[model samples]
Target: MAWKVLIVDDEPGIREVLKDYIEMNFEHTKIETAENADTALKKVTEDQYHIILLDIVMPGLDAFEFLRRVKDLNSLIQVIMITGNSTMERVLESIEAGADDYLLKPFSTKEIEEILKCSFARIERWRNAFRNSF
Candidate 1:
């Protein structure tokens, strides 16, 4: 299966590294980038992504608020919130904002692999349910 992914962050280097790492490690996956929450919102609305790596800090639009708005735009996408800060407050906030998972900025490769595995498994389950229903 070809999985579609989106990486949203204000830092170019973060986006580049994430894109490279995910691409190199994951097969049959296409990844897109958005520099800001505004662009992320637009992309999420116009496209379908199985997983979204979203930053907690962004200029112009607050990431938390963006996550909140995302619920209305599309709830099916598995959004994994990424942040430099690993405070319990932020984790709670991310959960409240509907993030499927939360990862620190310097997360290990294994962590991402696990996140992807779980997210894809969820997609597979949904697909199986739909196919069985029909």
Candidate 2:
């Protein structure tokens, strides 16, 4: 099955750019974008995503708070925090809030591709183990 990925960013340019890159590079993935946290939450509630690429600073709800709220909503959903301002505090907060991974803004597409590859591999392993047990 194609992996479902949600890209949450307040900036339309960033969202579009990331969506295009993911779609072009990751053939086996479905990409969804949410401009704000509220819409992202609504999407999360309605569908199951394999991974979430969340912007740290947003208008309605910051990524940390959103991560806290959604962490328990879907146990299989892994989050990768994305931020332009990569502060030590923000990194620590994301880790403490249960972020599965993080990417600094202005990152290269190759970097993101690598991160997704690792994340998907881990997800596949978990799914395989679960299926085997059942």
User: In terms of lDDT, which candidate is strongest?
Assistant: 2
The 10 consecutive residues of candidate 2 with the worst lDDT sum are 68-77
Cα lDDT for residue 23, model 2? 93
How much is 61 displaced in model 1, in angstroms?
1.3
lDDT of 1 by residue, 1-134 (tens): 89999999999999998899899988999999999999988888888888889999889889888888887776767889999988999999899889999989788888988998898888889889989999
Candidate 2: deviation at residue 13, Å?
Answer: 0.9
Per-residue CA lDDT of model 2 for 1-134, tens digit only, reads 88899999999998999899999988888999999889999999998899999999999987788898889897668899999998899899999999999999899998898989999998999999999999
User: Which regions of candidate 2 are displaced past 4 Å?
Assistant: none
lDDT of candidate 1 at residue 122, scale 0 to 100: 87
Q: For each candidate, what TM-score against the reference?
A: 0.92, 0.95
Name the TM-score of candidate 2: 0.95
In terms of lDDT, model 2 sits at: 0.90
Q: Per-residue lDDT for 44 in model 2?
A: 95
